[model samples]
Target: MDLEPPLSYGHGICRPRGFAKDPLVKTVPAIEALHPEMTEWRRDFHRHPELSFEETRTAGLVAQRLRDFGLDPVEGIGKTGVAAVIDSGKPGPSLALRADMDALPMDDRGGKDWHSHTAGVAHTCGHDGHTAALLGVARHLAAHPPASGRVVLIFQPAEENGLGARAMIDDGLLDRFPFDEVYAFHNMPLLAPGQAGVRTGPTLNGYIVWEIAVEGVGGHGAAFFKATDPLQAAARLAAEISSIVGRYLDPAESGLITVCSLQAGHSHNVIPAHATLSGTMRALKPEVMELLYQRLETACRGVAELTGCTIACKRLAEVPPCVNAPEGADRAAAACAEVLGEGAVIRDHPPFPFTDDFALFLEAAPGAYLFLGQESAMCHNPAYDFDDALLPVAASIFTTLVRQRLGYAGTHARSVAPPST
Candidate 1:
């Protein structure tokens, strides 16, 4: 295949002394060479999306591919999640490179032949791309070993519901496969494809998903003052809950409480005994999340007393804030610059309001999360699909971080023939 001189602006590939120094250093070509095959895998995954911990088929395929690349993948680590390590057979700090594997419980109506066949399930968050990029790294790294170190590729499950990363952690992710640092990325909407972005601290918000149930006396709707209306209590509770973020929390601080759903009586003429209110609370810090929780319970109690109804709240899932290490964040931002040009990357970017399950990994070790740009409909939108061309862009970022950490020097990196297609 015809190739160009690997960019030397900052050092691309360092030639190992054992093999003849061939001039292919940049990751763009090394990963781009396998881009076609990677696209095939991405599209196939897009066509069949799975949700949360039920990613059996997707996880199986991931393990099979890793095996094909000569990495002995361990499957079902965190209930349908997969992980494996690639050792350089030398001493160096170990780092975990993670990619979430699971799709949202939604459907994409986008006009494409490869749209998901599963009803009410699709990869609107671009996980299909995330998974494919890591696999590309596995293939690239296998052919191109680092100077020395172990890089663990973790394909985690159930990120959508905010339990995947933590589940993996509780399943002994840190204890079994030790690492000094962790890294992962998400695709951003409304930016130029391959444009990279990172934030040093408070990279993402912490969030809590909870549901509150109200119980009261049921009676005929015509019995005006005889029945304790749970539906009324639920309505009042929802309004009071909405005011928590605005009234109790500082306006300068970021906090959001969204009421996603409310369920009450099925019949219009009868007062139901029970009503439910569910939504999410998000903030920039964990303490803020705790305060919100306290206020919510207080509001529920007040509403319960006002309507003479009993209320109980349960937290479904909680995702901690994603805060990155200062040095690790700088290195990741530099790696983005390496792949997407200095002008194309943005450090100290505004924090993402959304929550990430990957934050659990940061709790175990120092690491960073980044946004890879792709111009399209916003994520979680039914029409969104991951941009395939960015696979090489992501692959380059992953490898650059590994090489930067391990200290690039002359080392033997196996060679793999580029795809003919």
Candidate 2:
């Protein structure tokens, strides 16, 4: 159940050997037609944001919607994730599209009309928008099945904590609903609202969090020289580790280290015997992460020697980088180009510093993870909210990606089947 992902998922995605040129934008207009309903769904989710592994009502709503669209939705994958299949009753290839469904543990300060109804739970990451957009795709796909193939729509949970993707994989997500390729996307801040970025290489970095525990003899502060002060060691380590991101890595390469939390003495008069320092290290390449761990252990050893403290470093939640396969990347770029124009897709963008659980999905199956540009407040910020105007855009992107991946060409391109919302 805890198997690590393959070292690299470099195979071509499921398509016509190569990516289709300029994915047909036939469904773009139809997706635009469903904008109002999609916005309603997104706002409803925004008002009732749920935290990781607890998306009961959100999952229920998605399930009902999928059912209404005439697809059999299976609940309870990866705790609160949902997966539904559109078999098309024919055979070609299976493609999977995923969107996360969870909110961060924070108060809503965006002041939107449909801000979080629950205090300390907010959808600052734009997952509400992602869910709604996927729902739009679900309705569209249900009404107009591809000529031949299966399309699996996955509504995942716990993305903020970086475990949901793995949980779903372990729960036989791949075995139960196997696909030739997989895809997912996240909204980005500060970019044009109608554009997206997709590349064929590492799109996001890998990260590992380390918690360092140091223990030394506690003694009276009046005679501090007599005792090994763990607090002093912790202070020194925290400052030095902060420089690791910029100092340790090459000037041209990308890496980050954040000494976020430190805990030590409780009383002013006494030097505490125990202290802990915790933070994270991120890098775009696997080798960089390896080198980072080595440097971290070296830092711990050097600090311990200087402070005469016993130090123990524990690595937590080491997530791998999310790289997009060539086929999937091309398909995604073409889809974006078809929907929003060629200028809307960035094929050679740099990797993001943050980590995504979707990395695990790409590792399991050759796929791509894209970023949709929408001018808005940065994610994870208290005031951040997904731009409602981007709903139809993302939905169009999803629709085009699916059609291109399945090679839905010719007459099927122009028709809009009976509406399903």
Cα lDDT of all candidates, in order? 0.81, 0.82
Stretches > 4 Å off in candidate 1: 1-27, 408-421
Model 2 lDDT tens row, 139-234:
988888776788889999998888888889989999999988889989876345555778898888888888999999999999998999999999
For candidate 2, report its TM-score: 0.88
**Tens-digit per-residue lDDT, 1-421, candidate 1:** 0012122121222223211112222345667678889899999999989999999999999999999999999998988889999888899989889998899887787668899999999988889999999999999787677778889999999988888888888889888899998999998764445456777888788899999999999999999489999999999998899889879998788777888899999987899999999999888789899999999999988998788999999899998899988887888988887666576677756677778889889888898998876766778877787887678778878988887788554444423333333
Instruction: State TM-scores per candidate.
Output: 0.89, 0.88
Check candidate 2 and list the clashing pairs: none
RMSD, every candidate, angstroms: 7.9, 7.2
